[model samples]
Target: AQTVTQSQPEMSVQEAETVTLSCTYDTSESNYYLFWYKQPPSRQMILVIRQEAYKQQNATENRFSVNFQKAAKSFSLKISDSQLGDTAMYFCAFIDFGNEKLTFGTGTRLTIIP
Candidate 1:
């Protein structure tokens, strides 16, 4: 069984600053993929970043980056220079190679304070 945890239920960051959202997961599988998805009021899950279990390098996309600590089963998202548009409900998800379903964590509502 695989489970994802987001300890923080809510987070607030000042505009133009940086914020890191924590996420931890438990899994017995040796191979998998971790993802950070942001869903705003519209409820569309947007892929923020993803890391493959075999990849040594942390995945980064522009201002969104993930710190993938494989051994610890920790995957956290760091948003640099946070913007108002970044405010959303962030979810951590996991998926194995053959599975089409995503196991998601309790979302963390992030607010960008101006």
Candidate 2:
């Protein structure tokens, strides 16, 4: 079984600043996908970034970027120029081919202070 860990239960950042959320996982599968998802107050899980275990390049999307450390089995999310809209619960998840469910971390609630 694969497991993800987010040690920080909550984080706070001022607007326009940057904050990085930590994530780590343990998996024996060689081929798999790691992902960061943001769930706002609306309860919708939105994809932030995805990193394939085989890929060396980190994934980035606008203000959201992931520092994917394949060797260390770590995937962290960095949010730049944080905004009020960025306030949400962030989750780290993993999934391998043929798997029907995504194993997820407990979550880290991020609060953006204006």
As a whole number from 0 to 100, the lDDT of residue 29 in candidate 2 is 88
lDDT of 2: 0.94
The models' CA-based lDDT, in order, is: 0.95, 0.94
lDDT of candidate 1 at residue 79, scale 0 to 100: 98
**Each prediction's TM-score against the native?**
0.97, 0.97
Backbone clash pairs for candidate 2 read none
Q: Which stretches of candidate 1 lie over 4 Å from their true place?
A: none
lDDT of 2 by residue, 14-48 (tens): 99999999999998888899999999999999998
